[model samples]
Target chain A: MDFWTLANALATGLLTGLVYGLSALGLSVIFGVIRIVNFAHGEIMVMGMFFALIMFRWLGLDPLLSIPLAAAILFVFGYFLQSTVISRVAHLPDHMQFLLLAALAVMIVNACLLIFGPDPQAINISYSFDSFDIGENLIIDKSRAYAAIAAVAISGLLLGFFKYSRTGKAIRACADNYLGAQVVGLKVSHLYALTFGIGAAVLGAAGCVLLLLIEVHPYLAPGYTLLAFVIVIIGGLGSMTGALVGGILIGMSEALAAIIFQPSMKSAFSFGLLILVLLLRPQGLMGKSVK
Target chain B: MMGLNLLADLTLRGRICLLIFLAILISLPFWSSSYIISVTTITLYLAILGQSWNLMLGFAGLLSLGHALFVGVSAYMAAYLFSVLGLPPVIGIFPAVALAVLIGMLIGYLGFRFSIGGVYFALLTIAFAELVRIMVDHMGLIGGTEGLFLQVTEADRQGFDLINLRGHPWMFYYLAMLLAFLTLAGCRTLLKSKLGYYWQAIRDDQDAAQALGINVFRYKMYAVMYSSGIAGVAGVFYAFYQNSLFPESVFGIERSIEISLGPIVGGVGSLFGPVLGAFILTPLGEGLTEFTDYLQSSGLIDPKLKLNGLKLLIWGLVVALIVLFKPAGIWPWLNEKLGFSRKEGE
Candidate 1:
């Protein structure tokens, strides 16, 4: 590929990667602290997208404008959902937790199905189809470019919060060692809720950004969720930077694979890459134990 | 007192229980219509799926979210062999089953080798299954997204004559029963073996099991292999019974969830739990749809209730309710409530 082509693909990959990073961050936050796999996280992201779509229709708001509202609404929903339902399951044996989470995921999907129906919803920003030229040869869709910037900015802000803030420190402490942190008088339950809220908020942001470039549907979240999970696993669990790196790698690989191979082969490539990475380094590219 | 003692006699109890079970099984065809028979047959296939999943997830404590991959792969293989090559299903089943096992080994190796445990491991399996489904959907060699269909004859229709593969509900019913029983027996035997102990040990704590000189990864892989093999057998039966193989129907996440539901609800890690769970849940699930259709036809409920998304709400609620209330499973809870715990000695 020529320099322009390579750069364009890389840019596209990075934009898609940012979305993956956002979603993975949500899951990583939950996994990092609670050590529970919120299998329904993807469904929740879908729900968030649905909310954003509703906002766009009812209030004539842009999807990007609905980001804060989506995050706030989903964050609250996630917090209560976890505190009331998921927390109970978290205390069960690990296998039971899996079963419970699967059950929850099913319930969420079913609920989404009931509420949203199967028809896909796409948001077309006026500028979504418009592209901007960078330097001499690189061209990028304005909406996609905006999405990439938003994802990076959101992720960067979250990382900054985690590194500097008080609640962030508590989250880090609880995730690092739940019991030890509890021993030091940290409110583990609150920390869990906080983590869940953040995760939900991150997904909310991803949902908004995604809806700008593409559409949202009840079933669509699982695809992104699974892909994001692959990214999280390959990125190394609980590592934000790893999630970013893994997302970019997978996004580029998928883009390249789709260019060279058939569209259907892309999922296979992503999944194959996930298995390969898991086999070689389960700890991930930037391997580190969460605890 | 003497009458009570007589009623409680061991021989009398055995005879009564056995007679009741046999009566239920035997009279099913007589009392129920052909439609019910087909339902039962489908339930039996699901029961096999549930039992297989329970063995791996419940007993071994290794979660696999992509079990439908096994069913789909085996079904497609069998379809290709039986239809394209003009091979009898009896002959085709072996290679399909073998291939399924090989795929299981590949998945297990990729997963357990790297020690991907818990939910991440399950997600890996789900991803793999979706990948397979996507691949199959796009590949035209096996009919692509249009799916593969087997030719049908009058003999293929459901009836008494068993010479041909068609129209024999009884064959499928009996085969499913036999397969379920065999699986139960096989699992029981494994549970009694040293390997079973190792599995339980590893499930409880892999590190501890390793410390005790057990090869944790090998045993876990064995569990996955056996489970996948059982799913393969069911896949072959399903292909013949349905006479079609669609990527969505055979290999989708929905199917995987359906398979896992039995084990989860019936009580994982128990011999008959998955069977019981499947019989209960599958019928209920099928019944719900039928009931919805009946209601819609009768104009009792809103015609708008026929919408697709509503059922998802009900399904999610049921699963969440089960998880919220009886996480150990309905069967175990029933057993406990009925004081059916095994005696200390045996």
Candidate 2:
């Protein structure tokens, strides 16, 4: 009933939604360009979170500070994985490709479980408890606000890179028409690997940001994977801008639902929304209508 | 049995092999240990579920990741009816299957009508299952998160209550075997029918099938309905056998994955693949659990360490290797090893 409580939840949801948008942006970019959905996207993101956590424990580094390292590590892994394993299945049937990724997801999640055990892992940042007064009685958690700001900055950088950089433009060209790119002497396969690397890197950065909001556990991989898929599908599977918007919308809905009803209703609201989108607007909010 | 010549195409050697296998299964409880009986019961349950999934995936080219939606919904329906409404599962299973067919049609219609084939269709089905799961989790009428437990009495436990589908473990084992055989035969019959041919055409190439004058949409719907109907039966068996229903255990992605693995591992597109897959993977799963228990009991590992994830991890590796090296599955390879080879498309 209180105005500020509702306002604060909305604000927090907006912030968390931005981070989710960034995470989904990773999935969207790869699909848009390579036309291959990274079924193990969430597992890769979880690995990034564990990377951040490991750095925090060993070197007393903030998760935000470890973002670059995690991104770099996952980038290399993603690049190699696509070139080696995923490339083999890129031309296979859709279900086979999905199975391959799910298999990878299984391997990654269990590997993490074996290494870190099945317990929830989190970090203690000094600003976790700190909040900022936005005006009136409304307040936003400092870490959340910082995460949102970082998310926006990273997303902006990605957009700029895509819009202006040579490699980014080449990736876009490939997305538009890879055969054309290959005919023009572009190394399509290497570019595909690069695009996948960038996708993994973005997911890694988002994972680092997510560590500020929630704890990570090995079992959480599938849920996050499903959540990411929901976001991308809602945003229009291959649309980057739409993915961000969809994430925001999903986060806002879940936050409001949590405030209004039980927290368990969050998934219900999101999934229901997904079904509606799939039925009524398969192209998504910002995607062009497909013929 | 239906005059479709179900085994006319099968070789005499294959028929004999099947007869021997059937004999072993029919007499398993009398000679096998209690543990093996229970394991075989679980395996048979999984085989039917896997077969149902394979109908859509392998036969119709519909890759549904949430086939457990049928299993979960039907199981919940029967469980709720039997426990809350005092209806026996025999009748309860009817409504359960009806709902599953309706849901399957809705999913198929949405995906097929909207041109959402491939992975998008898969996601659509997942959304339905997850939505239902969350809804069931909040509804207290079905026990919500606390879960539904079907009560068992001394008589129900010690005696064979075929009417109620409750009794000694061996009774349930026999029930599972019977259901498995029934479903296997049903799937075989369907596969050899006109509907199965249409389904195969669609799976091989939809545009080509349409060009050839096949009613693609109608046949695809039939595939979904028939597949889900079988899955519903398996769900009823699950509700009675387990005597417990939790949304997560039944409706979650894990169950869906577990059900799909047998066909993928055994040999997708083959009639016996799901059974072979169930026979192979279920024992491995049981062995993994037994190994973990042994390790814990022998004090070879830390008590607090949860090694259960490794079992799934191994499955992941197996699937990945299979996808890479043995895309056809294990059954066909096994057939070759056994000095018998299937004719193309057989």
Output the number of the TM-score-best candidate: 2
Residue-level lDDT tens digits of model 2 in B89-125: 8889899999999999999998889888787788999
Evaluate model 2: give its TM-score. 0.96
lDDT for model 2 = 0.89
TM-score against truth, every candidate: 0.93, 0.96
Which regions in candidate 2 have their CA more than 4 angstroms from the true location?
Answer: B2-6, B292-306, B337-346
TM-score evaluated only on chain B, model 2? 0.94
- Clash pairs, candidate 2, are none
Question: Candidate 2's error at B331, in angstroms?
Answer: 2.1
Error of 1 at B96 (Å): 1.1
DockQ of 1: 0.61
In candidate 1, the residue pairs with backbone N, CA or C atoms under 3 Å apart (3 or more residues apart, or in different chains) clash, namely A107-B316, A110-B312, A110-B313, A113-B309, A114-B309, B156-B166, B156-B167, B157-B167, B158-B167, B159-B167
The C-alpha stretches of model 1 lying farther than 4 A from their native spots are A1-6, B1-19, B158-164, B294-300, B339-346
Per-structure clash totals for the candidates: 10, 0
